[model samples]
Target chain A: MTAAVRRRAGLRELGLGLALPFVLVVIWEAAGRAGVVPQGILPAPSLVAAAWRDWAFADPGLGLNPYLGTWGETVLFSARRVFTGFVCAILIGVPMGIMIGWNRMVAGAVDPLIQSLRPIPITAWLPFAIAVFGIRDAGAVFLIALGAFFPIVVNATAGARDVPRNLIRAARMMGANERQLLLRVVLPAALPNIFTGMRLGLGIAWTAVIVAEIVAVKSGLGYVLWDAYYVGRMDVVIADMVSIGIAGFLSDRVLVAVQLRVLHWKQAVRA
Target chain B: MTDAVAIRGLRKVFEGRAGAVEALAAIDMTLAEGEFACILGPSGCGKSTLLNVIAGFEAPTEGSASVFGAPVSAPGPDRAVVFQEASLFPWLSVRDNVTFGPRMLGRPKDETDALARRFLDLVGLSGFEHHLPDQLSGGMKQRVGIARCLILNPRVYLMDEPFGALDAQTRMQMQELLTHVWDQARGTVLFITHDIDEAIFLADTVYVMTARPGRMRSRIAIELPRPRSIDLLTDPRFNALRADILRQIREEAIKAMAEEERARR
Candidate 1:
């Protein structure tokens, strides 16, 4: 209840969360050092951290290592793609979804097409993406956008559709024209759902960027991940995987912060 | 002079999987300008459906509802509604919800804000302007609902059991608040409720409806004095009006229950 008590509770939760991963890493390190685990296949946490440090902070002139001093750029490349693709997904999805949910004609015309195409995985589009965009960043962006679009649109539709009937009537009775009703009432009402879709879409966007990077492009964490593994630099591969996880987690946190700001009333309702 | 609200042979039917369910068979009513009328009925007596028709939320199957001689074709700010659940935009603060109608009508912000303040104050929600609907109690939310409609300065107010969900004490307080508000704003109101006390306390005229296939059973004029308060609840005349309306509603409620039991069998 008190601020001090709350802070202590938060600290305890953090410590508990870290304890299991810390113990796991310690056991893993012990197994590696004792030669009970093969180091070539899976390196210790220390090795991954050391390799990540070099990849992040090492002087570029010191060695022929391709990963030297490239961690930030590699992450930026993947992050930028995810950001652009996710934005595109939101731009196309939210309006399309609102329309589909709000109007029967739009739903009839477009929903079936989206539903049918949604079953096709992003991986399935890889060949087509490479063929059309020809291994460029555009191909990666296209795949990421397409991959993230489904969840965003689907959740947006659900959000828009589930608006309370009374709220609609209340808006109409308040003299809100159709456009004003949708923008002022329906949109705000569906915002909690829109955020839900965006979070799911962002996760998919990260997946999409990696898939795009691994096959269709050359400069992101995904590219380095595959490149490192081929050369048996499992340390770099593991570090890249950790970086992707951290990036994805951080992006999700940013979205959650925005959601909290926008849907504070929704949170109060739930509380 | 055109009546504030006029309905003639209004009928509503729902074509469900079970076939056509007649909600309102035939209903007729009229309210003079600035009159406060209450429709008291048993549950499922098409009382809300009647309000919905008048509010332009639902179309009548067989007849017409008009406001100030204009056929009700669509919902508009001229006929504001205070729903049973209060239906305040959950995302909006009390101030925002109260201002919603005026804002939607493109009224000047300063004018709307002042109106919102006055109405919210009228309902005793002046300090709670920043509170969301979720944060407010049932009575407080209903106050916001009343304030929002009052802010519109509508010709008619269609309320569908606005205090039905509140506790007995809160409901009484709300009824008093509403009467106090009506004294200030003075719009024609068609309030729907099942409570005999609420009807007697608030209405200039009370229209009691019968069970399913609901039709207007009786119309009782409450000759109670203006600016009525909770003190009026214990008045001898108030008790007499309550007893009279209670008997009619009780008969309808029994019929509704019997119909339900027969349908179940």
Candidate 2:
């Protein structure tokens, strides 16, 4: 296809995606304005948008609004927590997974412990986290990393385990030493699976961050969400919810984009 | 000169839930340097098991397999394999796959690059250097598999039905391509295939294997002239060889089936 035609098609797809959300917003606004829906219970989309605008752009010196000019800081705080936690999870999880999958002794020693710990929900660990780290960022980071670790490790293990037998044999026959076999053959073979784990772990990281902010720490979008709701600032609560959704969605998209690029050979084959 | 490959009393048994199943039984074979030998058998005849033992992918339950005077203990660059599935690394480009052996051995880039180019040309995949294995057709993938193994300059080629998965037309074309390549760079080859015509067309000698607890049932030396082509397929001698192999395989297959029936009963 020509570049122009491809561009037009892409624009059409964007329009199609926006159409439903646009309609939902319009209907919501109409309902709120007509009082068909109570204002206190469910604020209009426009109210939420206006509240988000004030939160993002208003001057903090106004002293009347705590949320004013703090949107960026809160977003950054939550993002940083998620990023650090996710990185920690990856650092521990990928190698642990490879070892577990590749070596029976490692699997025997580590797999049972992981399986036992995985059943405990991140929320259940909130008290333990707060008690251990005393409501600091470390507690939140610990919770987030712990929550994300399971999927990353599990997926990485599965990926490593599933490297084709022939590929290993072929690599060996081609004169790859033990290190080369693992690094060049098994690791690359397991990459697609590792990416899958990362995506799942990232989703869990977002969840862990919100939970940590709500109970263990007193900052970020999750803290603001609970704080806004308690004060009956429903508009800010809705805005915060939207902000979290956007953040999570965008982070997931970034991961998927990276995955696509890294696994281009896989996609090329399918095409 | 030392034999390119030597096997003596090689046997393979797999311990399964049911029982110990003998895959190969007292198999003995040898390949001289630069000779193309094919092992023809029915399905489940353990032809691949023999090849795997020779390739050092599997060890025999008894006896020994050695390549070029060295006892085969592990797979190495000295004995390259072309698998039935054309198991080229999916993540690598065709060029990368073909050059993988030399690159792993830390050969100079200029030398390996030249080798890769030459073999790629020989395999009729010159423009497909950048393409991944997945993007190529079955025939093309097998060609890449051949080139990859050939690039190693191994003492022996262990092919386990490398063209078995291709369609008949593609298989014929691959057979022709293989023979053409073999004529230029002849090595010791232990090719395993079920197709009688394929065995007769490609090998200097054809070893017919028995079904289940596979053993060397018969060995027939092909007297066909070298520099063979597809036109030789119609020759009377080719058909006579085919008939002989067919009769032997049919008897073994029937024996295998009867054994299965007895076990079921």
Candidate 3:
């Protein structure tokens, strides 16, 4: 294919992706302007966009509006919590998962405990988190980390366990010691599964952060959402919701980009 | 020097949920250094189990196997294996898979890379260094498996039906490639196959094994010309060897079928 044709195809894909959102926005704007949507129940996309702009760029001198110019700070706060909690989850969960999957003794000792605790919802742990860490950032981080850990650990265990027996035998025959077997063969073999778990865990991490911010913390998008709703500022609530969605989407994209790079060999085969 | 590999009264019995299944019994074999030997048998005749015992991937229930006078206990670099499925690490590129052994042993990067390049060329996969196993055809993947083992410069090459999954055309091409590679490398090879042609084409000695509770029934020496080629398959001498082996295996296969019927009853 010529470069021009390829470029045209690329543009067509972009247009196709944006078409639905553009249509939805137009319909939403028309409904709000026509008063077909109940007043103050659902804000128009335009109104939410305006509110979001003010929340992000309006000067604090305009005063008295807590959300004014606080979008960056709030996003940062939530993002920081998610990042910290997810990192902690990865550090503890990955090694623990590998151990549980690699060794029968380790599985026997820890797998039952994990399976038993997994059934309890992250929201159910909110009270316990609050009691332990006391409505601070620690409580929020704890909740996020705990929520994300289950999927990460579970997937990692499955990944490690499911490594082909022949790969292990091949590695051993190649003079790999037990440590080398785990690091070079088993770990790399388990990577695709580990990435799957991480993606799932990250999605849960975003949810946990929003939940924690709503109940136990006062500085993020979730807090803004609740506070704006209480004040009857539906526009601000809508903007906050959109902000959270964008943040979750962008973070997930970042992970997928990294996964694609790491699993490029897998991609090449599929391609 | 001691034999490259020796096995004495080797037996393997798998304890399954159904009952104890005897896979191999009273198997004795020996291979000289730089020899290529193939174990030919019917399906489920414990040929693969015997190869695994020699490769140290499986322990014999009775008696023992040794490589160069050392008792086989665990898999090592000295006994590199080429599994039937190729078993190349899917995540690694062809170059990486080929160099896995040398890299694992912490050989100098420059030396290992040179060695990898040499063997990749030897296997006719020189241009596919960056390809993943899944991207390659069955024959190419098997070639990579061969290169991966060859890079180790092993004392014994244990191949378990290395071309068993390929199409007939690909299998014949691979057999020719194997003969060329084996001609140059000259390592002791213990290849397991149910293919009579493959056994005769590749081995210096073909050990025909009996059906399960498998024992070494006969060993036939192939006096085929050196640096053999596919044309040898039509040679009168090659035809004679093929006929003799085929006759023995046909009887074993029939007996195995009868045994299966008995078990079913």
Number of the top-ranking candidate, with DockQ as the measure: 3
Error of 2 at B13 (Å): 0.8
Candidate 1 iRMSD in angstroms: 1.7
User: On residues B1-265, what C-alpha lDDT tens digit does candidate 3 reach at each position?
Assistant: 7999999989899999999999998888889998899999999999889988888899999999999999999999999999999888988889999999989888987888888889999999998888889999999999999999988889999999999999999999999999998888888999999899999999999999999989999999988888998889899999899899999999999999999999999
DockQ of each: 0.74, 0.74, 0.76
lDDT of 3 by residue, A1-271 (tens): 8999999999999999999999999999999999999759998988888988989999967568896898999999999999999999999999999999999999999999999999999999998999989979999999889988999999999999999999999999999999999999888888888999999999999999999999998889889889999999999998888889999999999999999999987778654
Lowest lDDT sum, 10 consecutive residues, model 3 chain A, at: A262-271
List where candidate 2 sits over 4 angstroms from the true fold.
A1-20, A35-41, A62-64
Model 3 complex DockQ against the native: 0.76
Tell me how much of the true interface, by contacts, candidate 2 captures. 0.85
First chain TM-score, candidate 3: 0.94
Give the per-residue lDDT of model 2 (tens digit) for A205-241: 9999999999988899999999999988899999999
Error of 3 at A61 (Å): 1.3
**By DockQ, highest first, what's the ranking?**
3, 1, 2
Instruction: Give me the runs in candidate 1 sitting further than 4 Å from their true place.
Output: A62-64, A269-271, B261-265
Q: Which sections of candidate 3 miss by over 4 Å?
A: A1-24, A36-38
Worst 10 residues of 2 chain A by lDDT: A262-271
Q: TM-score of model 3 relative to the true fold?
A: 0.95
Evaluated at residue B219, the lDDT of candidate 2 is: 90
